[model samples]
Target: MASSTIIVMGVSGSGKTTVAEGLARRLDVPLAEADDFHPPANVAKMSAGTPLTDEDRAPWLDALGAWLAERDLAGGGGVMTCSALKRRYRDRLRAASPDVFFVHLTGDFDLIERRMRERKGHFMKAGLLRSQFADLEPLQPDEHGVAIDIGPAPDELVERAAEAVQRA
Candidate 1:
């Protein structure tokens, strides 16, 4: 039931990459990090602690969507990490692959900020988390996904996401 492609989505500090990595391993599918799809200009701006506008994200989203489409075309599936903070962005991805299912990671701001602070070498610093939260729109009822709490350890979170995908 369209569980082939899974998207681990949340704000910048919600442990999307970590959980997605584990999920991909658990699911035995390819995985992609949304950051890798960004253009140099976009990465430069974000690395400077600036929040990206929708305009800056469009092309990046398109590229990531295309990647999903390619995986789907191959008759297998994959997992990916994406901030997908807005519904419109998720919509763009869905357009590329209608079966795309999202695993929305959610947690307290305090926990997320602490996570962002502790992580190293990430372009998205702790300062931008507030902006991401401000822009975040939780998955609606119509969306094909579940909201997962990020309080548990990363492995636990991944397990929860994997279970959700199977159920989907």
Candidate 2:
């Protein structure tokens, strides 16, 4: 959509990666998985069932921001799957590029928690779901983006999000 960098954002198990990949396919751009950028320490903490403090997330977010900035400067765009739980976290990404946009995936906590429980081999624990929701500040009034419920299947959700991006 308009060649801007897209951030498919939501807490873990909300299908951010699935949606981002589908959108990138539709948009003909690359897809970046936020989990790939996490430092070993961050991964270790998550695997140990410890939630990341803002301090712990700063470096990871910076690395992601830098990636976005570099892609933007090169006049190319991609979709990134990140939690971006807090407003400040999102602001950090937006600071990377003027055309940065977010797509918030909203869903019932129980639904997502169930999904998390069903998932295997992910560093993030199902117990961390509540902390994520607690920290989340949904897209603000002035934010440039779209918010969609994550109840549907991946294909439908991606289509809806892509439509929103097109409209934006």
Best by lDDT: 2
Query: For each candidate, what is the lDDT?
Result: 0.90, 0.91
Clashing residue pairs, backbone N/CA/C < 3 A, model 1: none
lDDT of 2 by residue, 1-168 (tens): 557899999999999988999999999887889999999999999999999999999999999999899888777788899999999998888888767889999999999999999998898999999999999999997888889999889999999989988998
Q: What is candidate 1's lDDT per residue for 32-102, written digit by digit as tens?
A: 99999999999999999888989999999999999999988987799989988899999999999899999
User: How well does candidate 1 score on lDDT at residue 93?
Assistant: 98
lDDT, candidate 1, at 30: 90
- Poorly placed runs, candidate 1 (over 4 Å): 1-3
The Cα error of candidate 2 at residue 83, in Å, is 0.3
Error of 1 at 57 (Å): 0.5
